[model samples]
Target: MTSDQYAAATRSPTDTDVERPADRSTEPAAIAVEGLTKRFGSGDDPVTAVDDVSLRIDPGSVVGLLGPNGAGKTTTIKSILGMVLPDAGTVRIQGVDVAEAPRQAYARVDAMLEGARNDYWRLTVRENLRYFATIGGVAPDSVADRHDRLLDQFGLAEKADVPVRNLSRGMKQKVSLASVLASDADVVFLDEPTLGLDVESSLTLRRELRRIVEERGLTAVISSHDMDVVEAVCDRVVIMNDGRIVADDTVANLRQGFETSAFRLTSPDLDADTLATVRDRFDVTDATTREGTTTLEVATDSDGFYELTALLRERNVTLASVATVEPDLEDVFVELTGENETGHDGGDSR
Candidate 1:
């Protein structure tokens, strides 16, 4: 980013004070949506992008929005950001109705959507940051220290004077994130923020993002396919399927329900008949054999596990190893969405 860009970023139309609503006893939610619905196309084959979705994000919390392609995640996010007009819904940002007062509602909000496209390719990194901060209702000089800190945090200080178009794809992605932070928006939406970033960069971003959110008491909604990023940064995960919310809970709670009843056992048995008997008596989810030892994954409770062991001993099978199979976020996602529907649905909703 160049100093010239910062100099040019003066007060603009977005400069408005956020007005808090009256007649409320406590602070309002950071984001509140009621009966949100959206549809595309017409005729007999109308497609519903979002279906009566209602969500509330508390202040100073990081929530993850996850879904497969065409699952209405993108549409829901757009509606909340005021980019798309919902057919039926009321969106309120920090107690301010977006429809009733968009400027005041979104005055302290920022978003980085469509990857690195949010940045100006012709502008220098520093200039882009300054311009975005200005448009977010603050003078560039007011956030100069913030811009400097963001540049250093994202390792963009060295490339600050270089035009964004001349940077690498990964560098450009960093620049986009830096610009969003420079705006100093209390409520931020980031879609695929870690896309195109290397492993180190992704880790750095996650760490910094968590620290900043906690320090500033900011509310963030992150949408990404990278489960690791979501698991690491978000306090809660909201999963959607077929335009509806299927699961909304903390990561530990989601996984805890599936952690039990899954185990891996390895044994050396006599023959095929024994394997078939074991399969018939238990739910053999997976099986593999190597070096005359068969490894089987079974889904059963504590009692069933005891029965399994008894049956194995009766068949003269010598157990080699045993371990519990822990379910991760991906496993939970597949279980809720169906394995076959985990990929794109060939729709235009997203």
Candidate 2:
């Protein structure tokens, strides 16, 4: 929910032990999508871009929708926002059906899609926000206050009067974000929000987004290849691959559950038979030889380590060092997805 809805929900308390979910007809849904399927092209080469994906996002939560290039992530999001109609499935934002009621469904959502594509190049930052706010149906009285709040929070106050053409990519991004917040929409959709941002700008925006969701209580759906940003800003993540969701879980839980038994093994002048055994048996991800010693990087599950040690001892290979390394989301993603590319096409990972 947006800042406006946040106050109203608090003012009215349910008499029951637990408050009914925020998705009731009267309350408005944060987000809901079911059985989403979409196909692009036609005839012999019809591409099924999305295949039976379903997700329900709760109010006051941030969900990161992640995937590799051509994994149908962009297609899935487009369908959800009603930019493209799915062959099947439904989308509901704040309890309003997007298909049945486009205007009502979109009113509660503000999206910053692609790179600065949402902002007008000729308009000043303040003017752009003002214009979009009005178009988004923001009340005339609340528009000024919303603009002021967003500009300050996003560090766009200093660049308020400058035209979009004169601003740096980061400044323009902030301006786009301010325009988004000015509407005070219940759900905000940001696709690659940190693209083209410097280290500092990326850090600043990521920090501000976390703060925004917590303090403003606005739901956010972020689609990005930047796992660091996703880990920092999103409460939940849905990982998709090949037009289908491969993994869906919280950032912490996914990391905890996906145990990668990775070990580095070094041996003195590894024998061919032993080398063949390790190569053939274990998932050897990397190998290097130096100073009369060869090192093998093996990635395996819980039981594989025992087999690895035993096999090494029997082969007379002098094992030097073995260490377990904690796996991050990028590593997890690489193992889980075949496409590898995380954003657009051609495998240059988003």
Candidate 3:
């Protein structure tokens, strides 16, 4: 990621800073952010990277953070982790304000962040997990068990002794994530967990993550550009645009609830005026005539189907076929984030 969109995991809590869990068992939200705002620089040139964003995560729920580059998603997560101080607003982890009580808030959390920046490349896979877990406050006696569990869960059992530098990018990515789980934190934050790797690797890791989160009853907040990953792993999503939250809901609701039925009308022959005539009564995303057929894709509800088809008949376009296209996660993401590309989505991918 270029510019300030680069995601960074800046905090490394000591064993004393963690170990004992925060006294937040009764808290409803594992992570709570309210009216968060951050601006870099000063005066007229100030860039507001996070603006008035607020969200809450129920315990044991997995939520996705999505947005275009420079949308302040990275800044928002850093704010929650207390790695980046905000210009305004409050971030509370399990009822403890991060800015006011970083130790208490951080005690319950572990993060596998972007670019594998959280790992020590010179260390072996198992060594990195051991070090991170101990430093993050896992007990010395439990380190070996944690290490072995992480290696097996990540399918790195065979490469447990391999140095981080020697493994492929995908293997290293798995190691990075395994370290987060090894910490045994109550809350986990994964920034672009599927940024690297091929489709198969991504699928495997996502499945493992789901199993881990569910089995452990862990609360997780994941940031990613991979819509498929979000759809597969997240219970809900909070979408951002230009530093502000635009949508927050479940994937199914985001895909089905926010969308109107879009229909594609095909005809053997058609005229531009015919499309214009249909446009008078319906919303059209695109209409193109290729070869011997004209195809028009338009947004409408079920009730509008009869009206649209009848209009086509009135226009004499000889509608050959008509079918509805339901919006997918990708379509919803683009519509909400308002940008198709983002640098924050990936860097040094496997």
Q: Mind giving the per-residue lDDT tens digits that candidate 1 earns over 107-151?
A: 999998863379999999999999999888889998899889888
**lDDT of all the models against the reference?**
0.83, 0.77, 0.78
- Per-prediction CA RMSD (Å): 12.0, 9.2, 10.0
Q: How big is the RMSD of model 1?
A: 12.0
Off by over 4 Å in 1: 1-26, 265-321, 339-348
Q: Clashes in each model (backbone N, CA, C under 3 Å)? A: 5, 5, 0
Order of the predicted models by TM-score, top scorer first: 1, 3, 2
Per-prediction TM-score: 0.79, 0.75, 0.76
Weakest 10 consecutive residues, lDDT, candidate 1? 1-10
Give the total clashing residue pairs for model 3. 0
Query: Candidate 2: which stretches are off by over 4 Å?
Result: 1-28, 263-323, 341-350
Q: Mind giving the per-residue lDDT tens digits that candidate 3 earns over 1-93?
A: 111221111122332343332444366788888899999888889888988888888888899988877788888887888778888998888
Which residue pairs in candidate 3 have backbone atoms (N, alpha carbon, C) closer than 3 angstroms, thus clashing? none
Q: Best-fitting candidate, measured by TM-score?
A: 1
